[model samples]
Target chain A: MSLVVIGTVAFDAIETPFGKTDKIVGGAATYASLAASYFYDKVKIVAVVGDDFHKEDIADFKNHGIGVEGLQIKEGEKSFFWAGKYHNDMNSRDTLITELNVLADFDPIIPDSYQDCEYLMLGNLTPQVQRTTIERLKNRPKLIVMDTMNFWMDIAMDDLKQTIKLVDVLTINDSEARQLSGEYSLVKAANKILQMGPKYLIIKKGEHGALLFHEDLVFSAPALPLAEVFDPTGAGDTFAGGFIGYMAKVGTVNFNNMKNAIIFGSALASFCVEKFGTEKIRNLSSEEVSARVQQFVGLSSFVIGQ
Target chain B: MSLVVIGTVAFDAIETPFGKTDKIVGGAATYASLAASYFYDKVKIVAVVGDDFHKEDIADFKNHGIGVEGLQIKEGEKSFFWAGKYHNDMNSRDTLITELNVLADFDPIIPDSYQDCEYLMLGNLTPQVQRTTIERLKNRPKLIVMDTMNFWMDIAMDDLKQTIKLVDVLTINDSEARQLSGEYSLVKAANKILQMGPKYLIIKKGEHGALLFHEDLVFSAPALPLAEVFDPTGAGDTFAGGFIGYMAKVGTVNFNNMKNAIIFGSALASFCVEKFGTEKIRNLSSEEVSARVQQFVGLSSFVIGQ
Candidate 1:
């Protein structure tokens, strides 16, 4: 019933066609923990922030039932920051700035209370941070899910490969899946990556939908077609959060259980795109989430002639 | 139920990386009727062929439960012929040869025997011919489905618009849907085109899968992932045949019934690509078709908990 999530908890500036936001509270761990918080109350979060990291932000997490005790704030440094501008297509964008501040040199400290958490989510971070966190765990959690960006694939593929072998499931976007497996056909890509280790491979196709591959079985869950997709910043992490969070709540890792989890993930992602990073998913009502999930369930269900 | 299908019935020379076929029997109607024959025996086919059209080739349709009484054999004329080469990516092809021959000015003549048909399938043809056939039907069929290519959208858009208003459903591929509606998003294109006429829209995604849109309901059926795709020439027509054919077999036009029909169509199209120019679909045993349908049924069926 407990979860520990770790990645970057920082700031971002995003410009999309709908509008633009300057220096919003955005980061991997921020979105992940918020999404997971909806399902679990014993959610311990770990991240390195600088003096600029708001104390009121920690208070907000505490109010949302997220344990912010594990967050380590360095007094004199600035937090990691990123800015990007989206194109008309909204699928591709250009990064305008990346300032690695406190994140440039950091060490993760897993708290004693977090050791007993049954679920562990590794948000996109350095391979060493991910590997070191696993090493810090006093006992193995029930399930470990990891996410990584293409940046690490280019610089630390070997380390990434080694870390991938340790997780129960690996979640990556379509481009990263193709880049990592060197196969354009996602079916082939999933099969190739399966040989590299993880038992489950979730290839996130963004707007297209996600493909969940386990052995010879593959399930595609379509993304909800919202009229507008404002900011896509944390949609992926939000998806990962809902996927693992629902699985942890149900406490079953069977294929059928994961099918519903995938739907839940897609529903959570649909909300993420309704507004800029974390705004929609953060305040999402249980009723709203349930309705959207039911819509997805309804779209694909029908009776057949006997 | 009796069905009448009219379109190209000619010769094609196609080459793919896997193999090549020289002057093989192909055409939109040729594949369409053959696929429909599996579900209904009394199927009438109409198409124009020339003196070069092989007698034995015409016999192939007759042997497959297709009544060729509506076929027009033009004396001293050449059979319509086309040649194309597929690239590694199956999404596109380059036409090497196209001799319009009998198809240059096709005017469909519905035989008295074909007048009793309850289902009408208008395969990809000139908009004028499609419109003429609709007018030629002595009695309106219970269900009419039409398929058209992008070429008609460019040259005979007005005729195509008129043709669209007369059919119950319209089938087109992804690119064709975009061109016909002048919309980039498939959902937007489908919405725009649906306003044009047909109550239902099936946008075939080739190897990826196909989408079925009716009113506000949409269902996606994935294509079977084959290791190799030999040829994709008549797959779309084969899909339409299986689609309308199953609807004929199911005896209803409800969304639930058409949902399964899409799966059957997808399964039939999957078999069509395993060999060149309808070779695989023609040789498929009932057991093989049932087995492939079962795969699609398995791939999409998953129950979720509340």
Candidate 2:
């Protein structure tokens, strides 16, 4: 079973307290594909980037065993670029610039070989585009997980809800969850959002950790406390990647499996923040990934009865 | 073994979005002692309240199997009264009034019978008072856990630091941890705070949960998410009470034991927020406490591959 990933593949300039990064490889699809590649071998990417994007970058996807047949290159255009500065606390950021070039009129084309995808990950994108991609699929994937942000809820809420209705799982941050449901209590927010469509909801709280809600069951995963969070640009995307990747690898969608997937996703995201814009995510070895997962096991694992 | 609790025992008026309460029995030591009573049988309270405090309030302590020998009742004076209003979020509050009458000239006199205490809980109070209680104990307790606030750190840094040095575990909120260590990252903040002499540190994140940090090892316990947080008053003190109470019951002071204590503490704190002041905590049964703790285990429990 293959895993399909769809979102932006673009350039990013990030400024954090630790340091600043020049325009480097970033985007929802880029981080998602890279993180998923670590767990699942048959990873397919459907994203649009400008001709300015170098060939080496495409080769990097191939090196990670990701299919590039669906990656489209628009001629005579620049890749989507985002510039943002993170506050001292690393919880909030101020967007400096968002230049959507090729992504403005982008279209996703799924390669015929990618038709067998069993797990679909819709990264943060225009809700309309997400719905279009879902409609384009020949057969609905066994599991469809979508990640969205407050931006869509603020502007294209109708489309966002429509897209949400088509997915099995939805992931968003804490404040976004509050905004979407108009409930300050996350438990109440999760309950309200679950009625809107997705069978599962994951509320990402950055350093505070992530919570997964399904029906009457809830699972909370803790974020590993690090001495520094170099950059948080692609951490959420990376988390989604690891989550879908693990599910695709295990070929299961049960609650127990999802719990483990959350841990795996959290472990991957922890590595993503140790450096800027996929730099840390790109070079991870199997041993490193295993060790990081162990850290999570240590961080949250406890036996009740002694 | 008996657990000795030292802190304010006073009256409080609380206002929350749910409702408001008149002069109810509420204080750090009051909450601490009551929470501890659920775990340990011999819980001794060393605090001073004025004559204005109700006779039935003292009876309530004895009813919970708590020792009132160390409790001093000052004649013809009002008890320390604090009025606070909880915001809509229920995570933060604003102090509306503070009337430190009986607590001002309060001298904590540890009764001779209380000298057999094995666990010591120092709830939020003046650093000098906490230090004095520690010094007054004829024999050092097996374990000392101290809780302090940012207020003390702001006005009496020297005394806070000195008192912190004498404790085995120090519990403070996330922002207070940052303020005390001058570091924004909790991991860095925990490292710096550990240097101040507490062998273990717990950075309580209110609704998010709590983190236990000790030399290179960390364990995170999530707070049980509720549909409503009616009131947050005395939750922290209740947490400390449960933690030390569990430790005293188990008669152990290792990382594993501390992990269980943190979970037990989190369970009790969850109930504290469900109702205003100590109403919920005051009427808990052992079965109810165990069931609450089971919820915490379910919320965070996950099994990875062996």
Candidate 3:
């Protein structure tokens, strides 16, 4: 069985307080698949790129033992490009440019050999396309974790809700959770969203950390506080990737496992922010990841006397 | 021998989305001492009120087995009164009125019975007053926890810095940490603030939780996510009281104890916001507090496989 990640595979130019970078390999699928490869061996990607995409970048995926049979490269068009600059706080950013040359009319195609999908991670994408990927699969994956942004909720909420109902887990940021549920309290928001279909809801609070809600259970994971966030791009996707990757490795779909997965995901995302794009996450030793996970254990562990 | 709480013990009129309250017995010392009473038996208050202050309110302190020997009753003078209205989010508020009657040019008189203080909680008051309390003590307490706000930073930063150096622990919300340290990153902010005076610093994030920072050690405490915050008037004070009170009960000052103390403090603060003023926190049984602490343990506990 394999873990399939479907989303954009494109280029990004980013600027942060630390520095700026030229067009580097970035996208929801790229970050997610790379993160998943660290935990699970059988990882595959389903995304559309362009002729402008470098050969070495595709080889990089293979270097991590990731299958790219579903990564489509258009012959003549340029790859999707995005440019953004982060503010001083790094919490907010401004989009400078968006050249969606290949992503605009892209179609996701699942490979025939990848039909035995056990876990699926639908990275941030159009609600309609995300739904189409699910429909095209011959059999539903054991666990479907879908990540989306506020942009879709703003324009295509009805379609978003429909897709949301099909997934087992839905992940969104704090403001997006507020927008989707129309509730100020997260406890109330989680209650309302759970009724909308997903069995689990993950609210990503960026620096504060992430919270997981399943039925009446809530698990709060602490984010590794950094002296500085070098780059925030792809951190969320990295988190989603690590989460599903760990799930696939354990082959479990329960609250306890999901809680551990969040810490693993948070550790990977913590490394992702130390450098631009996926530079920090692309090369992580198993030892380094284990040590980082321990840091989280130390940051939040406490014992009370009876 | 005792935990001395020094701050206002007057009245507050609050308006929240759930409801509103008239002039209730709400103040830093009142809330702190009450919360401290739950964990530490010998809790004492040091503040000034007026003849208008109800006799039953003074009886309430005694009811909790709290000492009010240091609480001065000014004859024929009105007590300090504050009125505020919370916004929809329950995070921001607008002050409607502030009448500092007995508090103006007030003198804090420590009773001889309070000379055996072992732990001190200096609530939100003028920096000079916070410093004077420390100076007047016959012997320095084993641990001193001082809480302040942005209002003091805006007006009396110089005095604030001087007082902060004398305390063992300092607690302020996230924004105030950023303002005082001139750093956006909380990790960096905590580092700078620790250099100011206190060996440990806590940046309170309200609903998000609280962070404890020492030299190189950091601890994150999760706040119980509530369905609704009826009133947030004295939550911070209640947290401080719970923290120092737990420390006094344990009879030790260390990182491990501080972590457990924070959990206890968070539990008390969680109950403080459940109703208008102190209605919810006034009458919690030991069983309820223990159960709430366990909920926090359940909310954040997770184990990673070896």
Best by TM-score: 3
DockQ of each: 0.44, 0.90, 0.90
The alpha-carbon interface RMSD of model 2 comes to 0.8
lDDT of each: 0.85, 0.93, 0.94
Model 3 DockQ, alpha carbons vs. true complex: 0.90
What does candidate 3's lDDT look like per residue over B122-224, in tens digits? Answer: 9999989889999999999999999999999999999999999999999999999999999999999999999998999988999999999989999999888
Candidate number with the higher lDDT (2 or 3): 3
**Stretches of candidate 2 above 4 Å error?**
none
Write the residue-wise lDDT of candidate 1 on B1-306 in tens digits: 488999999999999877788898899999999998887788889999998888987888888878999999999999899999998767689999999998988889988888887889999999889889989988888899999988888898998999999999999988899899887667788899999999999988775577778888887666666546778889999999998888888777888888888888888888888789978877778888888888776666667666
Query: Which candidate has the highest lDDT of all?
Result: 3
Q: What proportion of the true contacts does each candidate reproduce?
A: 0.24, 0.93, 0.86
Q: Estimate each model's TM-score.
A: 0.95, 0.99, 0.99
Taking the tens digit of each residue's C-alpha lDDT, what string does model 3 give over A68-183? 99999999999999999999999999999999998999888888988998899999999999999999889999999999999998999999999999999999999999999999
Candidate 1 backbone overlaps, count: 0
TM-score of 3: 0.99
Per-residue lDDT of model 1, residues A104-166, tens digit only: 987888888787878889999998999899999988888899999899999999999999989
The candidate with the higher TM-score, 1 or 3, is 3
Candidate 2 local lDDT, A1-306, one digit each (tens): 689999999999999998998899899999999999999999999999999998998999999999999999988889999999999878889999999999999888888898898999999999999999899889999999999999999999998999999999999999999999999889999999999999999999998899999999999999998998888889999999999999999897999999999999999999999998999999999999999999988899888883
Tell me how many clashing residue pairs each candidate has: 0, 0, 1
